[model samples]
Target: MRKIFTLLTIATALLMAQCNQPEQKVDVSPISDATVKKVTAELVKQHGDSQKERIERGVAQVAMLWRITDGTETDFEQFCTTQFVSDDAALEQLFNKLSYGFEMLNGYFILLSKELMKPLHLDWGPVTPIDELFGSYNAAAHLNDDLYANKIAFITALNFPYYTLKEKTEMGENWSRKQWAYARMGDMFTSRVPAQLIQNFSTVNTNADTYISEYNIYMGNLVDDKGQTMFPADMKLISHWGLRDELKSHYANKEDGLAHQQMIYQVMKRIIDQSIPQQVINSNEYKWNPYTNTLTKEGNEVQATPEPNTRYQHVINQFKALKAIDEYTLKMPNYIQRKFEGEFELPVDEVEQLFIDLVSSKEVREAGKLISQRLGRPLQPFDIWYDGFKARSGIPAEKLDGITTKRFRDAKAFEAELPNILTSLGWSKEKAKFIADRVKVEASRGAGHAWGAEMHNDVALLRTRVPASGMNYKGFNIAMHEFGHNVEQTITLHDVDYYIMHGVPNTAFTEALAFVFQKRDLDVLGMKEVNPDKEYLETLDNLWSCYEIMGVSLVDINLWKWLYNNPNATADEVRNATLTIARDIWNKYYADVFGSTDEPILAIYSHMIDNPLYLSAYPIGHLIDFQLEKQFRGRSFAAEVERIYSQGRLIPQLWLKKGVGEPLSVTPILEASAVAVQKLSEKK
Candidate 1:
């Protein structure tokens, strides 16, 4: 669905004996305040007052990380005095060397990781235990510790130092590209989580990912009360992406659409509350009736067990793993802080408020009413996924599938056409070929994702579920989204001037570009929309999308908050809390619009279980997508994307301002959606 940011690989941990043990605090800095002050004074005297700020920040940073094993106070002082550089030319040379070394180190590590994860991620043979073991091994787990032991980390820290989010925001306006790269280099050694902990996190995260990747529901086996199968006999779908997309697809069917949607909605509820039969998940031996929550085998009802809160257990396991690392972090002591302030570079309160404003807006309610009118029936809770605003909703699923399957028969076929796809989006032939040659498409075992390269010499990967028969329309759409991520990844890494600034501000920005590409899927297929009211419909569609995902994101954010507040909670407790949070969010934001309350459908996103607190990025991405779309109006799409993305890794607001001429806010989408609703209502 979205590109997985691999930087937080250390945040995930295994549910083993080490995870069960009490957290051992790692706050063992031996350098005292006097030592830090003495080092700073000595460096400033040697370097001059012109380098005062750098010297002071550098010394303090090194002092904070120096441990008893690292050396005594004299060693720390000596290290800082000897390593600190005041000359501009020498410093630039040092920065270049460090950047080159880090790029090699990180790039190879990523390559190794991708290779190890192949059996688990790719649609190869069945994954064996050895495959899982290899996947869990973090090749670069000890790299940070190794750097510290060799005093390279100290050297980097002494020169570059660390900048708070506040400092970056306040000073970034006047900062040159080199200054920003220096700031990012400063970010490399902020914390020193143990290598063992890092390895453990990797193992647990891989396990969780494997769990999600294999969680497929045999949709064809699901029967109605009358024992009639609604889906094709071989129709298997992964939870929640596959199931959710299938539900969205049903909106095009006027006759059986409602029944199919209701069935999918029931399945979603069962998944959320953990009431679905254990036998029905990833198995087709039993004929399951989701509506009645019954399973019949050989025309006889058989006993079945509910999933034993396995979903919630994964969440608890992740919480414990991340919580174990809490005491080790310095500036951001907890996962929540690290996620929002450290990673997102945005505050949680601000994100929550953004979602609340959009979901509670008059425009959302008006759009909901319009969706209800278009359906010619009362809106169901599942209507959160209304797809009629897009042109595809009016096209038959079989026709679209036939077109895609013929064009993209397999992964190689899709790979061969990447250049064509890029050219259709307005890139020059040479530029399109350059990008396409650097992107490799492969068949995925799970819902697809884009993995960008860390080195310019490497290629970005686009993975989607390409069936043996052919690539379906859904697969093509997901491939397009991931191709967007690859394009951004390639541009930022290969086009940007600095090695350190080779990515977007956060995963949300990548998701934004993915959304942009996804919206143009039909156009890329040479089936461009000829509707006169296209822009208005798109606005409504964007608004409704934000409305759906914002609530789900709130559930994810609030659930993490709950886990943090109640650290001793069990799996069942977490499950109950999640349901309550989901229901509360649904009642507050979605109930009035859909004529329903206490619906747990918002919690059906798989990200909550595997990727913690990642759901918020989608709604934020939608907002960004809308802004970027506005910027692309009557402009060369490829040129704007390349130029904007090449501005890599600035703080979110500054990046948005530079790209779209306005800071990030919901105002643009809200105002546009309000006008769209009014105009569409007049026509009705």
Candidate 2:
């Protein structure tokens, strides 16, 4: 078998080289038992090492592939081919191992770095998942600067930076929307953050969730007022999952908990099957050619048909109209454009008119000056929406006095009654204690916080640290969010293959898990029952915010594609392009109902600076949350919740498939949006 393997490898290599020459076919034979055993052993042995070593080795190996000098595509591919020929199996194994091991190590390092910085008393916090996301683009931003300068020749050879931006712009103009969507997704996956470090210190974790709880309570006492919480009463702070009840009741079939699985499956099926088509339709990849009665694209020419009567179609039409306006606005005078920028120093009448033209509600415009005076910004049209969104939706800030005191006191009371809470959620006494023992709480001021997990043998740590924090509804909501993360992490990390598939697929997936848990925070707070009223309100909020942000993601992606396409575009041009995309998206998605026009607030998402392409995750995760929440409605949380989280590190598609018997997709969000719209319309 070993001999046959060698001959087959040689034949395949020879056939590739002989592509222009006469091709000679060779018979291939099966491998022997000894060879198979050796390969299997190698695979098993390669994956068991510490994550740190694996990362260092992988970096060193990739570094060896291309010279720092610029090289052509032919040169780079040739180098890759040569390297592959020498030890293909070894290379493949190393690549797979590094992919899994290093990313988790990245998480571990974040914990270590934070722990190290605290000793020096520097303003060092663990590198958040957010930081990692933004950091992914560091190499690209600095590619022409220091980081990739030394490798420019090599990069240019493969048309690295050149082709990257070129493709984005070219595709933006000509690619089919479906093709563009897939390509953009590929770009996203490839741009995963590189593992860099803050010295050798890194980040570490264990039991800090308890400490955070106490701290939040302490802080809330000092900073917040007595009447209402300063924090927004958003979806992250409320909702309940219904997994366990479905498992127990006859609502779903139960053979080895098949009912719970079916619930998840139904949700997954709804999301994936529906979302793809909608996204494709919304993506402006192809240009309509009326002359040919078709949609003309760069790669393919096709017959055109009327769009379906779908929400996505409306979104597309809105964007197309907005895009036209944006194109014209870019050529407008600076004074006109600056008025649209966050440079509002215009007269009161003008400012008010801009607000009227731009904001969803009049209250938002009134809230703007208050926000601007506090933030020390000259009120701009773009500032009206966000400040107003917060002001209009959030709990008042003055009502939060003594909220922290209540949190600790409440936590203590709740701690004593946690067993009952668990029982209510359908847990046996043994199961309840098993979960409660894993939890540890710390009292302080500010807000409650949770750490993922730290385990020593059978005793795992689930911590809630609310230091100087408040327990107002909003504060309680955040605490609930942290708690959700801790619960999901503890269950998934401990129960899964600890060394390999230890965590969920990406930050977005885990974010979805936390979102699912957050829905139940109100129940934990003993405020509301998990009934349809609460559920309907939460769902409406989700759709409202998600619909808003989807347009924001569109602005971000289009702006990036625009800027990258135009290499010579100045910072001014980039900014203008961004504003254009922002206004276009907002007008298309929201202008009619908001009773507003000519706004660019959506483009100003801080996420654009901190983490590009990340704004989409919020809306996407919210969508997933809605679907999963539906699955868990009226279900037993105690029995099925942990099991769901424990299926860690599976690809998003595979994870959903395993948990819910369907691939990951966007149908869930769209369907939820339609339902939310219908419900909301009825309310009006």
Candidate 3:
């Protein structure tokens, strides 16, 4: 699946700035409680008693954001008295003006950032240091500062007063589309993080992203204990995504599948423990035996340096940068809170509990046993990525690669066929053309991502690595997934009712749609599932996928918690803690299923290194995808997706409930998987 760069990505970038800086005393509000009371009372008197709640909330919100530099108490009072729009028509007009202005500002800023990062993101050339610097330069870093300086931010905050997640959940059910738009407007300018801090965080984050992007393993150079190469001579796979996908593909290769999986498992362990030789990463100069951690050049053993714990150092740098912004964020004082409550609009405890419940379920063990029986062997640690349930697992990887490479000779070929891809999935030709026209495909420098456009006129960029030889099956599958994101991005932005409400509930929701589109990749290629028990097998696939990712997500969550507790710890300490956490989580949830303990394979996800706290979305997306698949069972797939996502940017549970008529839960998948396991077991 692809990383989604939406409005929240920009928000997070700006919010998580400022590295190693002491907390500045920015909490002292210039607008006093007395002034707030006086302003509220005066506004109520002027606008009438019926507007009391709006007056009070608006005044309080303005006061929360008002600094000494903003103005004096008297000036604050005058501004509120003069600017508070109590008339319904006038307030609506004000909202429209702000919404239009903000869309232009935000959309252009997003465009600028995307353009600046193109050299780093696209398959252009070798990324120079200058390219990295430009990628890290946030054009809108001072957007908040500028808005506040000109009082536009204060005006928006006052009129559309920020609401808590509790408030939204409790009241959003009764809200009109316009009310939801107003609430979204209130979401802007909630923090006053400085531009320098934002730039610093961007630099740190860009560096980490570059590290992960380039950390490819030359698989062809990997040697077994007997000095045998098991892969194609030209094959190189990036960490986690490329490696994991390569491992998953071997499920179709019965000849040497087990040995291949074991070698990849060892490679992952070395990476997690920082024992991977430095010369082997992104270079094929030496033939390295992953099993023995030895590098050999031209039949001679060569001394090699370990990676020096650079992975954990990046983690620590990100932590410190995010921690520096905690003081500026008054309501959600930490990065964790900001990420969950402020961004996801779901609490940390709730998400964690959801993951724990699913991982601990009995369905997982039954599914694992079923997989073991199919494989004719006891489960290995890498079997967490068990791909046997999918129909593709029965098809040879080479065949699929040949089909994809021939069909999509380049990025442009795929781009041109997108409309056909959409129409094959049940969209009308006109509708398909409408969506495909707004999405541009690009060959990626790293594992691809979907970069959504903030403005309606702009196009969403679907980036995936298409080798010079052509687009392979893995790249094609990923392109399909990214196409899902682009379709959603285009729909939510152009078809939604309000500018502020121009996205799904969160990244998880987008991931769900991506999964939906991904499952239909073979269908798009005119291949149908011939298996009589297709639905049951698919259910099992969803279950096993969630089982694997949920454990990884737990590691990401707990690792962040450990970082908070040990802020002063060294990279080596962080590395030790991460391995221990990965092992503990593995023992708790995966050991019984896979019959393996202390497996740090769960920590091998590139997302944990480059995109912090993002792993949870994949599993949650699986749950949502199951529900959406159920919804589309009898209905038109394209129509159902359009209907669901058009109701944009609601809270997750509310969005799920409205779209599929149930809240986000694992029960649907678990119950279905149980039946699937029983039926499949009977078939065998």
Residue runs of model 1 more than 4 Å from their true location after superposition = 8-22
Q: Which run of 10 residues does model 1 get worst, by summed lDDT?
A: 9-18
Model 3's lDDT to the true fold?
Answer: 0.88
TM-score of 1: 0.98
Question: What's the CA error at residue 285 for candidate 1, in Å?
Answer: 1.0
What clash count does candidate 1 reach? 2
Error of 3 at 71 (Å): 0.8
**TM, every model:** 0.98, 0.46, 0.99
For candidate 1, lDDT tens digit of each residue in 1-684? 969665533222111112333556666888889878887888788889999999999888888888888988988878887888888999999999999988888888888999999999997888899999999888888777788999988899889978999999999989999999999888877777777777776777778888889988998898998999989988889999999999999999988989999999999999999999888888889999998899999999999799999999999887777777766675777788788788889988999999999999998998989998999999999899999999999998999999999999999999999999999999999999999999999999999899988887889999999988799999999999999999999999999999888798988999999999999999999999999889999999999999999999999999999998999898889999999999999999889998878899999999998888888889999999999999999999999999999999999999999999998899999999988988888999
Compare the candidates by TM-score and give the number of the best one: 3
Q: Report how far residue 265 has shifted in candidate 2, in Å.
A: 40
lDDT of 3 by residue, 498-545 (tens): 988988888899999999889898998778788889999999999999
| Model 2, C-alpha of 42: deviation from truth (Å) | 16
